[model samples]
Target chain A: MSGMSDKEDEKKSTKKDEAEIVEENGLVYVDYVGRTKEDGEIFDLTLEDVAKEEGIYNDEESYKPMLVAIGKNWLLPALEEELVGMEVGESKTVEVPPEDAAGPRDPDKIKLVSKRQLQKQGVSPRKGARVEVGRQKGIITNVLGRRVRVDFNSPLAGKTLVFDVTVKGIVSGEIDKINAVIKRRIPGLPEDKYDARIEGGTVFIELPKESRYIENVQYAEIGIARDTLKVIEEAEEVKIVITYERPEELKEEKETQEDEENEE
Target chain B: MSGMSDKEDEKKSTKKDEAEIVEENGLVYVDYVGRTKEDGEIFDLTLEDVAKEEGIYNDEESYKPMLVAIGKNWLLPALEEELVGMEVGESKTVEVPPEDAAGPRDPDKIKLVSKRQLQKQGVSPRKGARVEVGRQKGIITNVLGRRVRVDFNSPLAGKTLVFDVTVKGIVSGEIDKINAVIKRRIPGLPEDKYDARIEGGTVFIELPKESRYIENVQYAEIGIARDTLKVIEEAEEVKIVITYERPEELKEEKETQEDEENEE
Candidate 1:
């Protein structure tokens, strides 16, 4: 009887493991706290009050809760790898090293430019002058012999950063929003679908009847959607569906429809 | 000799503590990231690619790092509270409950409106649609009798969220930019500063002496200049120089000048 009970326990454990894996495939939601690794300064938070108080808003709207999927490079590789097995409603603290966080600062990034460049730009490069070139901004670290050294390395590089993160909810929804989010997150995916639905907390996407070779893409897209929705909803119960039809089947149906049109 | 060694150890410990504090202060810069705690999924890393990415720009500049004093409530209060005494180059994970994170879903924020109201505003609320109202976007959870129950609760409510955050850099110089960031981060500060600078990685602000009161309100204005300078090198630094000659002092000088004119 004891052995039987142990076997039952093993079965239960297996079931739980399967459920966890399935849950991982669903949408994920989370809350987080971020700080600079160098100074232990908090940079961002999802807390409503914090967002409001900090005024990180668009016309008074706080930064919306962010969403992403597993296995997609939407986040740093280190962060993505850590999120793989997280379940809905589960919270975890993961430490991302400098390489995984923002990468180490590179000395090569810092460049020195002549004062003539500053004069051409109509800027006075003082001992502590800062300037922008295109999208990059640099502070004048030293003004020596008409040359200004500017550091382009990320300020937070080579520092270990900490984050207190909570997986809040997962999203499993209609095809349009899901696809929109996916496209927004991963720009490389092609756009072609016939119908889509979310049922029993899962998303089902169908391909056009004339389409060919979609099984692998379907699985990958579904997995991506599942993980993204999980982060959006911060919930565990998300499902996805993908359907594809062959071109031969579509051609036959079209011929039949042409015959019917003639009969009519 | 033992006492001397003990004294030297004490000095070394203090030096280490000071270095840690300096590191913390030096690690100021800005980046953007999105994550959830419940699932540990990161959706975005604005800091890493802010300059490279094109879409997330405001006023033709990407959102870069801005400085916020620790415990200043410039960010989420919970997140700010978590950052105290954190050493530079170290990362840690913190968990913020719903109350501290996104706050409990507010039922009062949920409302039902007639379809006509949406039509009046040129909005179409479908069965499961999301709409924006006055800087707040709510999702349509249900529709009944021309009424739509839109949950104003953050899309991330009740879920643990994660943020792979790092203090990329501190807002050290550019008083105008620092002041602008401060105003955006913390309102109610006055705007009276005429000059702002960073020396030895510390922020220095100069105010118009004519203004009898120089309060935090000025911080926000200075922050704006600082931020603008961060993006535009040609932007000029603010300088407030008050040269006041009291009426009594000027009176004697003027009389003497008049006597000289009469003699001439």
Candidate 2:
């Protein structure tokens, strides 16, 4: 009986393997580390702990294995094309030229502004200082007397990029896909905190108490709803449930005050 | 039959009057015109057309008969006191002393700011011109050479006020009370567009398409829920539903594209 069951399990595993392979329009979770080829400095990564170890941890972001919807313009074209046809637990290293990445730098984007003007605007003119002149933001390359040279192009405009990416897994469950969409908006919180589920055609997301009062949280809710409609085609509506409970300290204090009144 | 029905209507009208009259905590819709007794110029009013005709129209505000919860501090303490024990369609003119209205002006609030500094900060300081010095906003009462005298006091300070108020009606229905809570947040949209209902313990509000993308709409939704909980005693949860539909113009275009695809 054990030998018969093992052969049946082998066939089921083979079917699952074929279905889990990456293709266009498939949802896959991946871990990636991207850096410039020129300096080999790590610029971007998916895993949070790795980002912290590399000293690139961003407080404004929550890092995790990203859910990439293939052929959705969610990643660089060169890198996205390389991800196709990869199986679960597969790894690939892709190199992208400047043209395919941030586009080649234009000489016209580099210009000189008055050093005295920068000082008046509270910008201390020094080499490699970041500043915004008028509307363009750039890095100050040189400060020579009254003249300061600035480059308004993308910081990686002229550099080739190297990305080492690993396919973590495929998100096939309906609930997992919904959580993936929720993570894209309320990204500061832990992935497990967002309680996302789908019932019939409506997607419901219960925001954690930590995110109930975040800045522009309503905007984030609207975004999650709109993005879910796009990512989950069968989802007809999204209901974001945000419950604002009275603080425990306040509740306990109120109860204490009432008890004192009762005693009186 | 006509005579008997008329008698029955009279008995029903008496019961309605007993229920509709304003008292402490009663939600009443009122129209009010407030002006300083010292200068008969209107300082505040409720009606939109009247406000526009009087040249007091504010683009940032929505004008309608205000929902006033008597004794809830929704108006001046003196004015709020006058609203209690009022009846629907009842009109009253109440006078308020300067002390009971805007507090008496303090001389310490009047001070001189440097005119040269104002000019340097791009403020052309002239007599009666509004200016903000540091964190205090004030009117320039006098501009003499380099010294500009600014009065950082309430505009209605030291002014005796008179208000001609009329109670339009009382909001007694559950839906109307819910609408009052919603209108407070989405004041820009017309009242007729909002569809609010109470189902079991949940209060559902289907937001108008016009309000789907308003500034801070999520904030507005949250406020509506919190306010409803406070105002509607039976509402255990508030569900604000915002639906974004494809624009009519785009829908037609997509239909045409689909028809062509079917033919192909």
Candidate 3:
């Protein structure tokens, strides 16, 4: 950044005047409120206050802007297309069709199973109750004598999705782009936990301390590296570092020393 | 750090000089290579090179020292007691009795279920094969006609457990103490992803970006804050912040400008 040529430096200053647009492969940060188009029942939100206002204030979940890599399947095709050519701070409401969203509801996904099957699994199936049938999850639509009807179609399927989105920022740079991929593979992590840097076309990421021992984080890390190489073509190697620190011992020693000095 | 008094400064210096000993509630870091006591087959290793040598090199998982807070039940009681009073860099081998490890094997845990039951769940059971039977996991020991014998006991239940333990470092500082609790709740994370700092008894933690979207992470964050207050005592408030960076937008503008200059 400090070694820019005079001509390049001049261009940097004026480039902001030219509108920056979202395009394929561009990473974008967005603040969005998502709802069902039919009823407008809030399904998701990236703002804390809004979540609070909606009576969905979850102390465990901290809400923030979501990062999306354009042209990636991270977002529905309809939503991604609507975001393109948008500028920072620009806001728009996009409606996504069921086909482009969760996909149209399939009647074939519904099945009827014997009540004994649910009972054997210790599930007392009642109408409108959510339960897992075999490997698929579904809602019990009806219960008749010995048979229970389960609908496996996604609840959002066949319904239009409405997203109120604001383009907060667009991402670029080798390090930031890699971070986007990491964020996609591992969502809901805070920003600072990521340590992404590129050296000599290689990317190094230090997984945050809280992620180890997770059931399949090892596989996820490998998946991230593979996906990063595919999307970020310049990344030749992806190295992950896990660091654990012990700072309490020093604090205890200091406390003990302070206690001794006070006695003296 | 900049505003400490002369007395505080003196205490800090002497703390490092005092002979450090492991104590109750003291956090310790250790590098360990665990193997089966009977056969000496490597089960776990914290060094990458060691893992590579043992033909267990996994590119996704980074090996590092493990942090343990004494009396926290993170490690087996037998292993935790062995670590107490041990100095940094001290190494020891601990053998845990079956009662203290995964617990003694229970013959009652073995059962015979009809092969039809497994087929109904789409599971093919064979002798010595691992399979899930009605939420309980077991190893098939025999297939007699239409019956499959399954053992539900833990794999290590009857085995004498062993651990090669080492004391790597001790933890200090208020933030680090809180971080250990967070790490316990969210394992597999690196140390830097934590942004815990205590100011006027209130603890502020900015959840790392990769952690926010994880299922039940919200509960984990809330649990961490509650546990921090219960353990740290002085922490009055726990505030979590989720931040997203758009460094790419600035970088993109600069790159576009650079491209324009090259064209000229």
Candidate 4:
């Protein structure tokens, strides 16, 4: 009986392994509906009707929904954890609490700033308007004489949010499109060696000579690149080429291209 | 005096337009420190404290920071609005409110499920441990008796997240990854007749049969071919040949290649 039980356990483990292998890099597409918990207001939806009305995508293509890997951080951490073992072609509704979803609101995050700062920054602090304070951005919770109260808290703070997500499809590929967006957030990467590409539904990036040996560079690049690529779903590769060409050199290259085109 | 005022307005508009252009597309790199608003906890940091870490990036290479575009949805709307018109290399401390950040928590989003459901699904529910429920993969909030409570809220909900973001660099290119990612997300795309290439940072995708007055069959072939070519980001040009060969004929070609390789 003990041997039989052990065999059963092995079978379960084998099945689990098979499941993981099948989902290793397959694409999963899904449609989702998100709503605010407090008022049950529909905040976001991947449905065609709502997406079309909201102009969610720049093109007029029908809403194709979002895609995510089961164990990947394609979504938020908590959300990704929940999606790790789901099978394709399956649909289910999920309910999340504040802690597991967006978490409870923090009161200390609310602050009042002088209107002079707004003026200095050439911004008008209006009621119910969102604003950026300091180097980070915040929303205007309220406005009073000469003072605007902004909450640096998340919009869904203290409110329950519901997501009706449908797994649509799944895919796997190398990393791509990392440094392009990362450079926009950070700064000062030499131009010559950093490159990114997407191929076979994967994102691939090559770092600059300066960053070739950094472990964190690889980690952060891979992490953010993977997440960003997952969000887009169709990206097979994103290549970012880092170099040290001056602005004038780039301008010259542009002119040369134009000259060639004219000749053609 | 009226003419002078008009001229001043024109200058301001031009300045704004230039700023918009700069903000619209560019590459940047930065160093950042992230904090949670709930209790002022430092959740993440890009700075490393060791010499070995510094060596990873070679010369003054730091961890690549998050990137954002002024008018793009890359950053939160509130945050992007604030970043507009800011000079490069400028440093500021920004605080984001929960509402504008992740938003408040909600109670209605929490759902209660039965232990029988867990048993049937072969999952063990533990207290304080987050678990996914249903096909949507909602996070589990709590386990009580026969019922498990779950939350679908965002983990960052209602928390003011702070970032010490820097503007690093600027770049311009076609939104190649975005299109590729979107295409990959949707299934059943034609695999022929499509060709894509990146030159001068712009991505050009060509559909052979759909070029102008091609027939549906031609279009189909082009679509299939293009889909195949889309996977190759380095190919300057792609040629697709559609042949009405049977499965046996294709097998014969493969066998011939194998025979040649074996002979070699």
Cα error of candidate 3 at position B137, Å:
31
Pairs that collide, model 2: none
> How well does candidate 1 match the true structure in TM-score terms?
0.31
lDDT of 4: 0.51
**Cα lDDT computed for each candidate against the true fold:** 0.51, 0.75, 0.72, 0.51
Best by DockQ: 2
Looking at candidate 4 chain B, the ten consecutive residues that score lowest on lDDT are B238-247
Per-residue CA lDDT of model 1 for A195-258, tens digit only, reads 4455554444443322223333333443444443433332223332222112354345445645
Over 4 Å off, model 2: A1-26, A31-65, A70-85, A93-165, A189-193, A208-223, A226-236, A246-264, B1-16, B48-61, B188-194, B197-202, B206-210, B234-237, B241-264
Of the two candidates 1 and 4, the one with more favorable TM-score, higher being better, is 4
Name the candidate that leads on TM-score.
Answer: 2
What TM-score, computed on C-alpha atoms, does each candidate reach? Answer: 0.31, 0.64, 0.43, 0.32
Sort order, TM-score high to low: 2, 3, 4, 1
In the order shown, what is each candidate's alpha-carbon RMSD? 38.4, 10.0, 18.2, 30.8
**C-alpha lDDT of residue A134 in model 3:** 69
At residue B179, candidate 3 shows an lDDT of 80
**i-RMSD per candidate, Å:** 31.6, 4.2, 12.6, 18.3
Q: Write the per-residue lDDT of candidate 2 for residues B211-240, one digit (tens) a residue.
A: 646877766776777666655655567666
